[model samples]
Target: MERRDIEIFLTLAEELHFGRTAERLGVSGARVSQTIKRLERRFGVALFRRNSRHVALTPVGAALRDDVKAGYERIQQGIDRAMAAGRGFSGELRIGFSSPLVGEIIMAAAEKFRTRHPDCAVRIREIHLSDAFSALRAGELDLQITELPVREPDLSYGAPLLRDQRMLAVPSRHPIARRASVTVEDLTQSPVLVPADAPGYLLDTLVPAQAPSGRPIARVPTLTSRQELLTLVSAGQGVAVVGSQAVRFHARADITYVPIEDLPPIEYGPVWPGGAQSSRMRSFITLVRGLRQNEDDVTRSHDHEPSD
Candidate 1:
C-alpha cells in the first residue's frame, strides 16, 4: 500500500471518528471515507464498521493497526536516521532552560547526545521567567526545557521529561513552615508570589488566583528570578509555591520547603517552534522521551515487585 494510504488507515483506526481523523490529518471527512473505502476494496474485507453515530475497527483492522504501527514508526525513524547521516547532522543545537533542575536534565541529555552524535554542538542558555516562549519564537534557541501550560498555538511541545511534586516555599520562621504539610488553601496566609511579567495562564497554573475553597490568593510584588523570590520568602515578604526540584537545587537555611497536599506535579518538557522540527530537535526529543520511558519502566517494575 502507499505510505499516505497506510497513514490514513492508521490514523483513522486510532481516532475511530471520521470527523476527528479528517481534522487531524488536514483532510475532509469525505476524503477519509473515500480512502477507507478504497483500502477495503483493495484488501477485500470490511476494515471498519460505521454508522451515523460512531466508527469502529473490525478485527482485521485491529490486526492491521497492530502490525502496521511499529513498522511505520521504524520506517520514519529509518528515514530520519538516513537524513541525519546524509546531512552529516553536524549543526549547533541551542537549548533554553528555566530552572537548574531542568538545566541539569536537558544538559545531561545533551551530553549523551554529544557522545552518540559527536558532530552536533549543543548550546545551553538560561531563559528568563518572562522570555520562555519568546526565545523559542525568535529562533535564538532550537528547543527549550520549560514548565507546562505551553498552550501557544504556534509552538509544539513533547512529552514531559520530568514531573516534580510541588511544595510551598516559606521563611523558616513562618507559621506554615512549621507544618509538616499544607493544602493549596493555605496560600491565603502568604499569597502567591510570581514574576510580574509571567503570563496570567502560567501564573494560574503555578498557583491559581483562587484556591479550591474560593478564597482569592493575594498577589505580591514582581519577581525576576527564583533566587529573588527565595530572598523575599526568606525575609518573610511572602510565600511562594515551587516544584520539588527546589528542595535539591534551591535549599537555603533561611527557607523551608513544605509539601502542598493538593497541587498537581509540575510538568517539564522540551518545546520547539511548531514548523521547525529539525534533525537536532527530533533526535534530542527522542533521547529525552527514551529517558523518561526508561524511568517509568523501572518505577512500574518496582511497583509490581513481590514483597517478602
Candidate 2:
C-alpha cells in the first residue's frame, strides 16, 4: 500500500469523520473516500464501517491501525537516516548525558566533532539516569552517555569510553581523606549530597547499607547536579560520592576524592537504540572509544609511579 494511503487511514482513524480528515489533510472529501477505498482494496480488508451518520473502525481495522502506526514510525526513522547520510553531518544530533561529568566529555567530543564536521549541529540535554532509557526508546534522544551496562532489551551500547572506580568527595581536610580506602560505614553521620541523576544501581547495588550497629545512615538526598553536589561538598555542607572521573574534571583544593574499595567499578559509555545504526553514530562511537583507551593508558601509567 502507498504511504499516502496509510496516512489517510490514520487521519480518518483519529478524526472519525471524512470531512474533518479531508480538511485536516487539505484534500477534498471525495479524495479522502477514494484513498480509504484504495487502502481497503490493497489490504483486502474492510477498514472502517461507515453509515450516513457515523464512522467507526472494525476489529480488523483497529488491529491494522496499530500496526500501521508502528510501520509509519519505522518509515520515518528510515527517512531520517537517509537524510542524515545525504547531508553528511548537517542535521542536529540530540544527545543526552546522565550527569555533568559525562556531559563535560560529550561537550568536549562535540567540539572536536563539530570542528571536523562543521555543518553538524549538536544539542545536549542533561537527563536523569532513570529517564535515559525511556527517552532513547521513545526516539527523543539520538545518543546517551551513561553508566553501563544498561539493562533494557531494546537498547544497545558501545564499549565503555571510560571506566573508573567510585570515590568519596569530601572536604580536603576531612578525616577520611587520610585513609587509603574507605567502607560504607566510614560515612556514618556524615552529611552526603547526592545528584538527582545519580544511578540507583550504583547507590543501591554497590554501596553497602547499615553500620555494624545495623542502623542505616549512609544516604543524604539534598543536591541534584554534579555542580551543586560538588559545590556543597566544597563548602563543607556535606560529603558526596562520585566517579573517579570527577577527580580529573574538577581539581578544587577544598574537595578531595577518596578511594572507596567496596563499591563496584563504574563504566561510562555511549548508548543507542538496539536496531538503529548509522555512519555518524559509528564515527562518534569510535572517537569515544579512542578517548577511553587513552585515558585508561594514562591512568595505568600514573598508577605505577608516586605523586611528585
TM-score of each: 0.72, 0.57
Tens digit per residue, CA lDDT, model 2, 1-308: 67887878886886679986786466899999998888788879899999999999999998888788767857755664576567677777788887566787778778866775667787888886534577788888889888776766678766556656888899888888788888777767687665445456645543445665676755665665667777888788888767887778877888889988766777777788987656667556645554554566587688999878
| Overall lDDT per candidate, in order of appearance | 0.83, 0.73
Candidate topping lDDT: 1
Residue 294 CA displacement from its true place in model 2, Å:
2.9
lDDT of 2 at 59: 94
lDDT of 1 by residue, 1-308 (tens): 89988888987886678886786566888999999999999999999999999899899998998799789869867886788888787878999988887787677789878986788899999986665678888879889988886888999876566778999998998888789999978988676688777777877888888888899899774788887898888988888888888999988999999999998988887788887578788788767655665676589689999999
Q: How accurate locally is residue 123 in candidate 2, as Cα lDDT from 0 to 100?
A: 81
Candidate 2 stretches greater than 4 Å from native: 1-89, 99-101, 115-119, 128-138, 188-191, 197-199, 210-217, 234-238, 298-308
Model 2 deviation from native, Cα RMSD in Å = 17.8
